[model samples]
Target: MRRINGGGVIEETCPSWCAGDHQDDQATDLDDLAHSSTVTALQMRVNAAAPSPLLSAAILQSPYEDVTSERVTPRAPYVVFAPSDDDFTIELDADGLADVIAQIRQHADRLVQVRNQLMALRTGMKGTAAMSDGL
Candidate 1:
């Protein structure tokens, strides 16, 4: 497929989830030539005390080494995690993703423990308050 911005013909087959070529042909830098899949909202929170803002996940790919002589190594498609406001973005490969998954599970378990402790504390406080009212 031809790049819309006159970057030339794209040799790589588009991934099934890719939203199509959004890259600008006029972009002078290779990093600007990238393709992205449809964004998905992630059900996650950065802070437990505050309401979670929208987090998004999508597959992203820049021009591979085969397409550009500037790159030393072949570029691989990676998962991009970004916030709704696009303040920052994190790119991860398979191994990095695995580590993140493991850490998330561990943190989630810890959060559950904290929640249980908070519930118990609330119950104890309620009991003490009730006893004081009767006194």
Candidate 2:
């Protein structure tokens, strides 16, 4: 995976055919560093913009039937839940994680409320124990 970064001026080897210009000056070390740096920078940029190797491999191995075969463009599903919170059948990206976290937080609030209600009811029931003893 690679990305063409700013300026699109890939400072790569000027091509072997153009080596006549550098026959003098003993610039071997400088040339090596320049080429290596250019390659390294390109690699870094590509890795930053594109998906990781594991994700790429997963996409490549995906079943053919899963892809839309029709000529018409496929629309995204009408998302009932937020993208961050949806539990996808497939592996989710970073955006998915954010949604999932949001959903978890939302549900946690509800659970806390229910728990508080239950505790309050339990406290109320404690008084009934003494009344039952009198019976």
Candidate 3:
């Protein structure tokens, strides 16, 4: 079901069973309906030579999108947008997730420190900034 609540997010939510892990979940009527609809839509686009929604999402957003290994996963898997706007969907095992979490924490810390330094400079560099340029 796709609907906007108070927040205007276009969420695509299927039944819990329909959204289960592909390796674990067995095929069901709901799955068949979802699959067929998706296939039909893609086929129609192909037949008409119209742009596909899937392809639209994959279009390049920037020339310098960071293609990094360490990215936060909102769910079990991580969906990363590369420099070319290409989406790379990854399934991280326990170890991989742990590594990513650690990396995210480190980056968060660095960001906080950088923000503080910038704020200090903006308010009053004074004794904080050693170099003239930094001030």
Q: Return the top candidate by TM-score.
A: 1
Taking all chains together, each candidate's TM-score versus the true structure is 0.66, 0.33, 0.34
Q: For candidate 1, what is the TM-score?
A: 0.66
Show the colliding residue pairs in model 3: 65-83
lDDT of 2 by residue, 1-135 (tens): 111233222233443222223233132322122110110011123545752221110111111122363312222221122222223234334465457568768987999999999999998798788788889
Model number with the top lDDT: 1
Query: Cα RMSD (Å) per model?
Result: 4.7, 18.0, 17.7
Model 2 deviation from native, Cα RMSD in Å: 18.0
Candidate 2 error regions (>4 Å): 1-88, 132-135
lDDT of each: 0.67, 0.36, 0.38
Q: What is candidate 1's local distance difference test score?
A: 0.67
Model 1's C-alpha root-mean-square deviation from the true structure amounts to 4.7
Candidate 2 lowest-lDDT run of ten: 34-43
Candidate order by lDDT, decreasing, is 1, 3, 2
Total backbone collisions, model 1: 1
Clashing pairs in 1: 5-25
Error of 2 at 84 (Å): 18
